[model samples]
Target chain A: MLKANNKVLVTISAIVLFFLIAPLIMVIITAFGTDATIAFPIHGFTLHWFANVFAQPDFVAGFKMSLIIALAASLLALVIGVPLVYALTRYNVHHQAWFQTLFLSPTFIPEIVIGFALYQGLVITVQLPLLLTLLIGHFLLCLPYVVRLVTASMVLMDEHIEEAAWVYGSSRLKAFLTVTIPNIRASLVAAFMLCFINSFNNIPISLFLNGPDLSMLPTAILNYLQNNYDPTVSAISVLLMLFTAAMMLLVEKGLGLKALNEM
Target chain B: MKNRSAFLLLLPGVLAICLFLFFPLLQTIWPTLGGSGYSHFLHSGYNRNVLGRTLLIAVITTALALGLGLPLALWIARQKASVKSLLSVVILFPILTNAVVRNFTWIIILGKDGVLNKVLLGLHLTQHPVTLLYTNAAIVIGSVYLFLPIMVTSLIGSVDELNIEVEEAAAVLGAKPWTTLTKVIIPQLTTGILTGSILVFAGAMTAYTTPQLLGGNRHLVMSTLIYQQAMTLGDWNQASVVAVVLIIMTVIVMGLMRLVTRWLDRRPANA
Candidate 1:
């Protein structure tokens, strides 16, 4: 009976894992298919679609813009989030839980809501530029991850190490810079990568904030998919999956995948 | 001195969040303050259907994710260290992949002449290709696929926490597998189940891209309705109303999640 139960468990696990990976494998397979339209048993194989993806002006422009926005947004999130994490984790501030909740509240809300909220508040009411609003949207989207990952790292670090630096006549800022910063470097890198990828891959926020002049990579891909049904998107999807997989490797090396479950 | 430094340290990030996050949320809810948008939304039958459909889909996605996630989590929790990390990566792939890229694959696989139909035709399961894309079922499938990783990751912790000896003892007592599962395994997993359900439900409720790409315009969820009203028809009033409704749904789910976390803290003596 136990053996039979184990077999059932293994079977279910196999099926679920296959379900998770099947779409990704399909995209990868279709990327190399020579046929214009995706079909069963795929026709001849070729790499022309990859070339087509790079040749498209929108994809190129959107990729550059996505890089800029993601870098700026993740950096800003790190700058703003680091101080918040330090204070909350190190100090016994009043209403600390409430403050943490407020800081992390953005993650709980839907990105669609955040996107529309920023649209109404910044673009419509405050009259911010589309690019500025897009940055703010992405920054808000990345902030919680920065705060969460960095906080987890800081919490696990020995607080005494920073105090020891301070006790040795180093000033608070000096100790934080020389001691605390070095301790959390791996997690900071991990957090930045996580934030960068999230901002770059974001769709709803970019969808709402992007104007005709400014297009994000994900939304641009979305637009292309809407108008065209060729394997070029399949090629692009394969490329993105590869990029994200590389980022995941970086994150794993930096902060171990177990840390991601800190939430 | 400590208090002052803490406050100083927190000021910049707090101010940024207040200005960017809270302020915009206030703006979103601002237009609906007159209550006209609420009345307008409530009066429309189509709006009601969208709301109902959104809830229905969320519930279905949550149930499906839990059904699948429990076994996967259990299996992974029991695996050797080397195999566990590999399985973790496999599960994390969907979560880390770009949303557009992930949904694009579903679009192909579910299309009329797509892979699923191809296999079904090959196996003679159906006479002809059936319309699988752009339906409520597609939305549910896409969402479950999208969010199942989260459910599995969350549940693995609780599965790890379960004492193996108890299960061994139950089996030693000649209890049937089903009996051991119901009597021993499930009660301990209640918190995990609740948390996973809340996360998956919230995800499915607010998912814009999956439902947008898979369900198409014919089927409208609240998130898509907000996009359509605000962007397509230029109806900010109606869009704000739907956005506010989504925020409320999120808040309620998040509040439940908070309660679950608090419960986890307060109760440490789980056998």
Candidate 2:
């Protein structure tokens, strides 16, 4: 019976791993295969598709825009979010739950509603520029996550460390800057990466926010796939998967995999 | 200390969220306040069918995730610590990449002449490549792939907290593994099962990219239908109507899920 259970467990593990890993292998293999058609057992191998990803103007332009948006949004999320974490965690506040809800509400709501809401309010009503609009929109989308991670790090700390800093002739701000901030450096980096990935890969918000004039990379790929089907997308998918895997690697080295589980 | 500086620090993020996230949601909801949009959405049998279909898909996706997730969770629970951590990464792939990239994987996996079909054909299991893409089956498969991680994550969270001694006790008492699983393990999985199913259902229902890429016209989940009515037909009212209905449905499902969890939590005492 125990042997049978072990066999069952091993089989389930194999299937689960295969299910997760196969699509990536398929995309990677298709990207390298010489055929424009994606079929198994490649007869020839080529690097043409990787070059095609660079050659396409939309892919290039979208890549640039996505990079800009993701960077700006994540950076701004850290700036705005970290301070909120400090205030919420340290300072006494009235209606704490209300404040928490305001901060975290973006996540609990569906992305579609947020996207639709932003479309109406920002583009239609407020009439903001697309660049600024998407930045602010993604900032909102990523703020809750940033706060969660940052606050979690703070909570894990010895609460009296900051107080001890005060006893040692350090001001609250001085203590926070010197002791509190340094302690949570891992969480800060993790939060930034979390926000960056969220903003970088976001589609629902991008779907509504993407105008005729400007598009994010995911949205661009989506629009590309609507009219065209080719191995070019396969190549782009491979590149993106690699890029994110690389970023996750960086995060893993810096903070560890535990940071992502919090997300 | 709490007077000027902390307030200032909190001001920027708080203001941004309220201005960008909250007020905009209000704007989206405001236009639908009038009964006209609701009337059009409610009275339309076509839209009703879409709602039914969306709920059906969401439920089916939840069921599939539950079926796959429970066993995987159990297996992981039995593993060594290092193996468990490494194994968890496989499940995290769905979230590690963009949803679009992940959905594109389905094209290569489930497409006609795709890898799975090719393998099947090569093995002489079938003479022709099975048509998997552009069907409801394909969409369900895509959704399960997309949301499978959530189920696994929630289950792992709960499984790690589960008391292993109970299983050992059952074994010592002559209860078979299967008997212990149904009578002992599953009952305690109330929290994991509830959290996983609720998240999977909500995710599958609102999923736009995966359905669009894999499902094509064969399946129109709630999110896709909203995108179509708004973008394709240029009918914002109808789109907002569908969006509102989707939100209501999600909330209702979540409420129902909470009730189920509460009921499950109460059950062991009675037994």
Candidate 3:
């Protein structure tokens, strides 16, 4: 009876796991379909849709914009987050929990709320330019990831090493630069991956914050999807999956999948 | 001096978050405080329907995710290390991919002449290609799919910490497996269940792409309603009211979950 129960559990799990991946697998398979509109049991295979995805100006531009925004947002987040996390972990700051909560608050707030809030505050009220507003939105989204991952790594490392470096006549900056940073390198990479992916794949923020001239990749794909129901979207999705897979490999090499699980 | 130094370190990031994030959040909530927006929202049957549907979908999504996620967590927890990592990679794929890309695939699978209808017709299960996409059920499926990773990841940690001996002890003490699951194993999983439910609930409630793509314009959830009000209708006041409603819903759910988890935690001690 116990063994039978185990079998049942395994079967249920397999089905659930399949459900998680089935959409992605379908997207990959349909990318090569010769049909004008996407359908199953594809009549013939072709690389035609792959080339067709590039023919669209909006997608190419959106891809470029998304790359720039993700890169800038992740890099800026790291610069601000590393120092903030280091201090929070290392210092005797008052209301440290409040500060930590403030920094990490973005993760808890729904993205639509954050996006709409920023749109109202920045775009409407402050009158910031669209690109700057977009940058700010993406940066807010990225900050929580950096704080969580880096803090986890920093908390685990021995503070004594940095203190020891200080005792050996090293400046605070020098000790932090050499001793503290090298220890948390894995997490930095992991944090960057998380930040980059979140910013890149984000929809709500892009949806609210973007102007007519500005478009993120996901939003552009959404625009395309609204008008067209073709295999070109499947092609774009397959490329995105491949891009994510490459990033996953890089993270695995740099940090490992364990760091991702912790997130 | 230490505090001063810490403040200096925090200054840049804090200023950015406060000026941009928190300030905007306040702005989003500020209008609703004036009473007009809430009165307008409360008066509108359409607005109330969207709010009701969002909450209902969120609840159903959380429950379904827990049902599906608990078993997957247990299965993954019992796997070998290498196999565990492999499964983790597979699970992580959806979490990492673009939401639009992910939802788009569902559009393909659930479309009129899509994979699902085709299969159903081929098997003589249906006489016609049923409209599956842009329905309430499709939104639920997509929401559960979008947030299941969060649910599974949260539960896996709790499941790993669960002692197998406890369940065995219950079984040996004249309890059936079902009783052990409900009484022993489930109690142990309270933390995971609470955390997972809250995350999944918040995610499903605020989700835009899944509902926008799968539910389409006809089936509007709060998130999509906010989009329509703000972007399409260009009414920031109405949008902010909806946004505030969403924030309140999430906060209440989270607070209630914490209380329930606490009650569950203390139940055995009381007994």
Quality of model 3 by C-alpha lDDT: 0.88
Interface RMSD of each: 1.9, 2.5, 2.2
The sequence of per-residue lDDT tens digits that candidate 1 reaches over residues B135-178 is: 99999999999999999988987888988888889888988766
**What is candidate 3's lDDT per residue for A108-200, written digit by digit as tens?**
677888888888888888888889989989998999999999999999999999999999999999999999999999899889988999899
lDDT of 2 by residue, B8-107 (tens): 9889977887788778877778888965888878788888877877777787889988888888888887788898778777677568788988888888
Off by over 4 Å in 3: A1-5, B173-175, B256-271
DockQ per candidate: 0.70, 0.60, 0.66
Best by DockQ: 1
Off by over 4 Å in 2: A1-5, B1-6, B116-131, B253-271
Compose the digit string of candidate 1's lDDT tens values, residues A1-263: 12223878889988999999977897898888888787646789899999999999899999999999999999999998999899999999899889888888887889998899898898988998999999999999888888888988899999999989988999989998999999999778878887888899899887788887799889999899889999999899989988988887777777787655654
Clashing pairs in 2: none
Chain A vs. native, model 3, TM-score = 0.96
Tell how far residue B261 is off in model 2, in angstroms.
Answer: 7.8
Which one wins by lDDT: 2 or 3? 3
lDDT of 3 at B20: 88
